[model samples]
Target: MRLETRDLAWSDTWRAARLLAHAYRDGTIWAAAGTVAGWRKQASLTLLYLAELLICRWEKGFALGAVRGDRLDGVMISYEHGERPTPWWGWLLRSFSCLFAGPVAVARCVRISNDLERLKPTEPHVWYAVLGRRDDSPGVGYALLRAGQARADALGLPGYLETSAGEEQVRINELLGWTLRDEYVLRTGAVVRTMWRDCPVKVAS
Candidate 1:
C-alpha cells in the first residue's frame, strides 16, 4: 500500500478538528468539568484547537491518503519545532473562566497545565505527530509516525510527545522506539505519559 503526506493547510482545519475532538474526548474526559466541559461544550472549536496547536506552534506536516484514487483513507497532523513559550495567559484565562465557568473548570485547567510542565524540554528540529483514520484505513497510525520520524531525521533532532495511558498507543510507541520519559496525573486523574525517540539514531540506521 502507498500513502502520501503533505503540510497542513488552513483549509484542513475543520477536518482536523473533528479527528482531534474524537481523539481527546475520551482521552481528556476525566478532567474537571470546567476544562473538559469547554472542550466537550465546543466540540467543533475543540477540533479547531487541535489543528491550531499543530499549525500555530509546530513547523508542520500534514497528510491525507487516498485509496485507488478515490476514498480519503486517513489524515495525519504533525509538528517539528519547539514552541516559542508564551506568557501564562492560560492561567489568567482559567482564573476568569472560574468566575463564569465555575470552580471545577478552573481547577481542571490549572491541574492540567501544572501537570504538563513536568516534561523536560527538547531542542530544535524535533517533531511530534497525531493521527486519525477513517475506520477502514489500516496502518494509518504507523504511517503517520514514520512520516514524522522521517521529518525529524531530516532535521537531525529528536521528537517528543505525551501519550494517553492507553494500551494500543503505548504499544505503537514502543514499536516505533519511543521510550517513556515522564508521566503526569492531571486533575482529572488520567495519566499522560511523555515519550521520546532519538531521530538521529533512527535516521542513521
Candidate 2:
C-alpha cells in the first residue's frame, strides 16, 4: 500500500520521534551528537530526535511524515530559508528540552548546528535537515525527498543538505540530482558530505 505523506501533527510527536529514532539508530552520522553527549544507542537517538523535532517545530521548520494506517513510515524534516524568524526566547525554550541529555549535549548540539549553518551555501535554498524511515519501508525516504524537491522547485530555489549517513547515502543523493559540494571528516572518523540540488523544475531560458 502507498503511504500517505503530509504535515505531521504535533499531537503525534511521541510516535514520530520513536520512528525517527529507530530509522537512524544505526547511522553513524545520526549517532555523533549522542556519542559526544554520552548517550547510549536507543536512548541517545530517541532523545536527539525528540529534541530536533521540538526545536524544528518551534523554529517554523518543515516536518513531512509518511504514514501507513496507524503509524508513521518515514519523516523528512526541513527548513526553508527565511520562512519565519525564530525569537530568542523561543530558541531557549525549545533547547531546554534537550537538557535531559546533559549540558555537554546541549553545547555540542549548538556547536554542530552552527558549524553546519556556516558550511551552507549563501544562496537562498531549502535545508533538507533530517530524512529517515522505518527499516521495512523500502522507498519512503526517497518519496519524501521527492516531495521536498517539489517544494524547492515551486520556490524556484535549490535544496541543500549535509549527510554523515555514509557513502551509500551519498550515491543515492547523487541519483536524486544532488551534487557533492564539499565534505568534512569528524574527529570520530565520520565523513559529512555537503550536497546541493539545483532547482528540480527549472524553466528553459
Candidate 3:
C-alpha cells in the first residue's frame, strides 16, 4: 500500500499511543514491566507512552507518521540535539505513577532507565526514541525509519537507537546502514543492542 509520511498531529496522540502500546506489548522493557504488574499493565503502559508523546512534542522533536489515506499506520518519535531533557518533576511523576504497576515493575523501570542514560551518546546527535506500527501495516515501519534518518542526515547529525537483540531487528538495522555499536543485557535479562548510523557527508565536486 502507498504510504505517505507527515508530521504527527495533536489529534494523533491517543491513537498513536494505542498503536505503540500494542506494538511493544510483547517485546520491550515497558511490556516486561506491564507483565509483572498484571492487571495494571495496559493503563501503566498507555500512560507512559502518552507521556513520551507529550515530551516528544514539547521538545519539538520529529514525530513522523505514516498514513494510508488518513489512517495513521505507523509512527516514529525522535529528538534532535539541543532539545530539553525530560523535566525532573516529569520523571518524578512518572516514577511515582509506576508504583501502581507494583514494586518489581518499578525497579525494572528504574534499572532500564539508568542503563539507557549511561548508554546515551555524549556528542550532539539525534535519538531515535520510539517507533510503532499497526499489526496489519506492512512497510510502514521502514518508511518511518527512512523518514527519520533523512531528517537526521539533513541536520548533519548521527542517529542512535537501541533495540532488542533479535535477529530480525539486527538485520533491519544492517539494511539501513546502522552499525552495531554495543550490546548489553538488561537486569530483566533481555539483551539489547545499540546501533549507530553516521550522517551522510557531502563531498564538494
lDDT of 3 by residue, 137-178 (tens): 877878999999889888888888988838787898889989
User: Which of candidates 2 and 3 is the stronger one according to TM-score?
Assistant: 3
Global lDDT scores for all candidate models: 0.57, 0.75, 0.79
Residue 136's lDDT in candidate 1: 65
Give all candidate RMSDs, comma-separated.
4.9, 3.1, 2.5
In angstroms, the error of model 1 at 64 is 7.4
Clashing residue pairs in candidate 2 are none
**Per-residue alpha-carbon lDDT of candidate 1 for residues 1-205, written as tens digits (9 for 90 to 100):** 5665555445665655565555545446334443445544445335344534444433334343323243344555545564533335533433443455456654665567566755647466453544556556667667767776776777777878776747688888888888887877655676778788877665677
Q: How good is model 2 by TM-score? A: 0.81
Can you write out model 2's per-residue Cα lDDT over 33-133, one digit (the tens) per residue?
Answer: 55533244456567667767776788877889888887789998888873435566545645544555456655666777677767888878888888888
RMSD (CA, Å), candidate 3 to true, equals 2.5
Model 1 regions more than 4 Å off = 1-3, 29-76, 84-103, 125-130, 133-138, 187-189, 201-205
lDDT of 3 at 20: 79
